[model samples]
Target: MSQNLLIVGAGEFADIAYEYFTVDSPYTVVGFAVEKDYLTEDEKFGLPVVALEDSVTRFDPAKTEAHVAITSTQLNRVRERLIKKTQDCGYTLANFISPRAMVWRTAKLGVNVFIFENNVVQHGVQIGDGCVLWSGNHVGHQSVIGDYCFLSSHVVISGYCKIGARCFLGVNSTLADSVTIGADIFVGMAAVINKSFEDAGLILNGHPAEASRVSAYRYFKLKAPT
Candidate 1:
């Protein structure tokens, strides 16, 4: 029997999550939910769209699970906030691990993870809650990815590396072995990280990635909603 799932958000990521979970996982997506103010449609993907505040009552948290399908927008703060909100509503979060992902049996993953196709999570890897590993990424042995991190396509996390909470590793970025990345760091596309960075809230870029003067909020254009 498939478990019922209520996917939060009605954006592109939510649609992608719906497709992945429907085709690859054991969860059956029964509905979509978003903040009432953000809702513009009554239905999506043929599922009834409900306000997230009322989703618990409509979906029955005891029988249904939820997956927050928001992207790493706003330095991942938006996704993190919704994740916490859903958890507080008594819905256990669901993980969507693709059947095509080569996750070693020794790897540990927390709830609400979305690991896409061809992700190679090697032995002894620890992926924390609400992390999203896009397709074709490589997580090397014994690496630790902290909570709510977003690893984009083709990112390579070398062995024994520690990526801190709420970090965003862009496509094709490479982390050297044994490096420790501080919390809320943004590693830009194709950046090669060869050393440990302890400072948080940095926007790192370039071939050998260096901290940019721009904040993530400014670089990513993440302004508070008006």
Candidate 2:
């Protein structure tokens, strides 16, 4: 028998998770779960959009399982809120790791995680529950990613970094070794974090990027040493 699945958050991630469950997962996605305030649509991907609190009693978590599809683009507030709310309603969160993803045997993952295609999770990396690692992220060894975090595409997390809960690392962002990212922090796209962060708010791309002179020499076909 196929397990009945309900995806949380009916935005873009809901659509993506819907396709993955239908085509990739063995579970049968029957519905979606969202907060009553966020429930503007009646249905998503031809499935009912039930409120998070109503899901356990209505759909029955004893029979059906659920996953959260919230991205970490906006300070991880939505993802963290949904995770706490869902679990409080007496439902066990589900985890979705893509078959195409490369996770090391020693990696530990928490509940309600959605690891997408081509994600390379190295050895001894501890990923907390309700986390979403989007496509093409490279999680380095001995990294501890906290709960309800969202990592976007092509993110490079260097070794031994401690990422706090509900953090959002934007696309193509690179973190240096042993950096401690605080909870509810937002790293902007392609930003390089060479030091630890303790603030719990937005980190925008502050300065203009300097052009690489070596790369410029190579681009102009000059004699740039290898």
Candidate 3:
């Protein structure tokens, strides 16, 4: 039986989630939900868009599951908050692991994970709740990805590494073996993290990644849309 799903977001990521879940997974995306203040349209992707505050009432958590499609905005605080709220509403979060992705049977994953096509998650890997692994990434053996992290396409996480909660690893970023990334860190696109990062809230960039003085908000230009 195909499960009904409610995606919580109306933006780009939500659209992508809808496409993947509908075409690749067994879940049928029934509708979308966002905060009432942020809702600009009544429907998206040919489905109804409900305010998140009333989502549980409309969809009924007993009949449908949810996935929060927000990215690592506000250093992932927004995603984390929304995820918690969804759980509090008694909705079981749905995980969408692409049929094309290669994930080891022994790999443990928490709820609401979105693993895209061509990704390889090796044995002993532990992925926390609400993490999104974009296309073509490779998570090596024994790696631990914390909750709510967003890893963009083609990122590589080497063996035994520990990625902290709410971190954003940009496209083509590579983390060396056994490296421990602190929470809320943002690694820029194509950056190579050869060493462990102990400090939180720093933006890392360049070939051999170095911490930048700018916060994630400034580095990613979150305050104003580009």
Residue lDDT tens for model 2, 26-101: 8899899888776787787677887786777678878888888887644565677777887777777788889999
By summed lDDT, the worst window of 10 consecutive residues in model 1 runs over 217-226
Ranked by lDDT, top first: 1, 3, 2
Which candidate, 2 or 3, has the higher TM-score?
3
Clashing pairs in 2: none
Give lDDT tens digits, candidate 1, residues 1-226.
Answer: 8999999999999999999999999999999999888988989878899999888889999999999999898778889999999998899999999999999999999999999999999999999999999999999999999999999999999999999888999889999999999877888888999988864546456767888777655666766334
Residues 1-226, model 3: lDDT tens digits: 9999999999999999999999998899999999989988998878999999989889999999999998777767788889999998889999999999999999999998999999999999999998989899999999999998999899999999999888889889999999998777888899999888864646456878888777655665655323
Global CA lDDT computed for model 3: 0.89
TM-score of each: 0.94, 0.84, 0.92
Which number leads on TM-score? 1
Local distance difference test, per candidate? Answer: 0.90, 0.80, 0.89
Angstrom error of the Cα, residue 102, model 1: value is 0.5
Q: Candidate 1 or 3, higher TM-score? A: 1
* RMSD from true fold, candidate 3: 3.4
Once fitted onto the true fold, the runs of candidate 2 whose alpha carbons sit more than 4 angstroms away are: 206-226
